[model samples]
Target: MSDSNTPDPNTSGAPVPPRPPLPDSGATGHPAPSTPGQAESGTPQPGNGWFAHAPQTAQHPQAAQHPQTAGHHAAGASFSAQPTDTHASRTTDAKVGSGKIVAVLVAAAIVGAVSGLGGAAIGNDMFAANGTSVVSQGSTTVTVNDPDTVNQTTGIAAKTLPSVVTISATSSSGGGTGSGVVLSSDGYVVTNTHVVTLDGASSDVALRVTTSDGKVYDATVVGTDPIYDLAVIKLTDATGLTPITFADSSKLNVGDTTVAVGAPLGLSNTVTTGIVSALNRSIQIASSAVPDSGEQQQDQGQNGESPFQFDFGQGQQGGSSSSGTISIAVIQTDAAINPGNSGGALVDDKGDLIGINVAIATAGGGSSSSSEAGSIGVGFSIPANIVKRVTDEIIADGSATHGLLGAMVGNAADAQDSDIAGALISDVTSGGAAAQAGLKSGDVVTEFDGVPVRDATDLTAQVRALAAGAKASLVYVRDGKTLSADVTLGELTE
Candidate 1:
């Protein structure tokens, strides 16, 4: 695989995608000065605005083929330094009256450089004891002391980099590289299921993981949950590894600082910084499937349950009936998520994992064969709460079980248009959780597990967030009467 930093000749001709709109609340400072042929020092420069660096390749392995849909696979983009005009130069003259001016200029230069001004100004008084003409047209280099302040991006990267890893998977069909996060010291890693499996097949896939220290180890699949787009893999021989900490994603708020770490476009250990752009976004992408004589066939779990479903608006079904699609409630961020960033960590300011960087919204609309563009700042990640719940189930058993309400719920938009305040039950499965709980058709589910159910999508997201067999209380309105009942959630079946 090619390194992500390397430029690609193929993509050189492609048009640069438009950037997503950024919030106007942040400080609008001047850009930092450019230092050609120099390496980044990870210092937070004043006016060092963020931008999405296009990946070398547009071929994201998980990118969706359908452009008309909202959920499309996207890769992570690297964040690189851009030129700015924040740095300024000062000149000192060898005059009797210029001593105070020179001292003030030097002090200002030092302060500016330390505060992310990107450069420093020096006077000739320090170099020469006697009054000598030091001011010249030639350029002079100034050195400044490193600031004591800590950069949040650098700090988060330092704390979590060891726990992140690069995952390379090869199968008879094809091979690609992605990222993963360590879950246990003995080598249990969590990644997107698509990272380890082929497009259409699960078996016969070979997996390997490369840690931050440059050690490579063979790995095997422990379990996979395509419905949630997550998987667990174990290294053949791993020990004493640092595992990442999970944060409470439910408490996240918009504008909270976020850092995304992954191997974008095969460039390992890349980090990008941004804020939580939004929350509770529902996205649906095409499910992983193999082509059968030009027809797509959805992959089923061991229990024969289809792992994906489409959420067509107004409760109308869309897409191929035989094929399935995965719908998820995601955390949105402006962090540069590109191809190869799939299954990577989206951490908060404290270095705790809050989400898994998954798909990016591209200007090209993405295709099944290849990504048409890189990140546009609209990146989505699976919330850590869902990750924690689903991964726990996968680790406990070889498979994951989702909680099911066993009812056909009306679309939230439809309910709103019809003046309904909750999830309207269009039908209830016989002997299912709803039926057993005394819920009947035409009942509107007002609340689930103490959380308000604004619509069908809200209810679906809440149910998926729960574990199978968990006890929950449901409040619904039946025949214009409000009622409440305690129900034991049933495991979703094929």
Candidate 2:
């Protein structure tokens, strides 16, 4: 089924109006240029006081010398409490109390005429509310409502969202939808691993991919790296595809415009734009437990668990804050990303893919509650460079492998506690490379392949950058002894 470009109320509706704008608030609520010149209403305008003098009429030259009337209001001005235009020149010659009475009558009559005119214009429809007539196309329309600005993005969206796909995976419990981008003409698609992971085995996992055109394809998982929240699936015999162009994420700077395209809040093919709020931000995927928040409660149904897990055989205890940890840099933006946006591409103004939209920060602890699951102007994405490296590894092999040292490194501040300024061997896998090479717990590997190691995160990144089966020399301090060991790197397995 082709996803319609029509906006969804939850994802693309007009924002709720704040309190009415008062002149004293110092904030202007002026509509954009396309709106009518000014808002019309039936009320007394400024400069109609008893002592206020009317401008000498150049249009009415003959009446310029005549004193203005107390019962009359300026032309085009209407008051709910005044009389009609017939009392145009009621002067102060009348008794003070009588002048006030006539003024009130004139004001009421003018207001009645204005109301009658307004009612006719609206066809006497009491439901002619301001927001009812307008429809929001996306975030741009919600904010500016300018045709040029709204149309500026629609063309690109029309061509792109069709190629975007929604993925669903089923296990013993159930399944959910996540967004994906087409990767090849041969029907290969890429998305987040958690979206298609099987609780037991791949054989038990029922994976389905649906294009925006409503065509559903049965997919076979090609490879996955849950550590990076990425997965690839092959759609049989698919052709005539449009692959997204990848941009250099490193070139992206703060404040650069970006568009987030995905099926957020179950609204397919939704598009939102915002600037790169920050770059190279560090976010921890401590746990998969989503909070009991508004929309999330519906998305997460029951078990307060993540749809996926990051248990890579460190034996660090699954679900621990440290188990699913990927200590790396990420890009942060204000672009709205909701439930299904995970794994979708974060593209630049030119429509080139830059990053993979990922985890959002939740607002609570395990037993806490939340109000919304949609983007709160704080969304994060993995850099494209990292995605390229991991994807390449998975495509070349059936799975991904990262070079590893036998030790886990900590920050510099934490390293001082043990006087080991290198990758610290927290625990060693029995018969693994480090154990076989005489590297032991409490020993810190300070250098790798001639490069100095700073902390655990830096070490993990450097090691992952290297291919498995490579020879690396490590410099470590053991019980105050500086020792060197040569060990062949091993692939990190889950």
- Which residue window of length 10 is worst by lDDT in model 1? 309-318
Q: Encode model 2's per-residue lDDT on 17-70: one tens digit a residue.
A: 443433533356654231121114322111110010000000001011111100
> How big is the positional error of residue 493 in model 2, measured in Å on the Cα after superposition?
3.0
- Residue-pair clashes per candidate: 10, 15
Tell me the tens digit of each residue's lDDT in model 1 across 310-362.
Answer: 11001011122224545467777788776667777887655667887766664
**So what's the TM-score on candidate 2?**
0.53
TM-scores of all predicted structures: 0.64, 0.53
lDDT of each: 0.55, 0.46
Predicted structure 1, TM vs. truth: 0.64
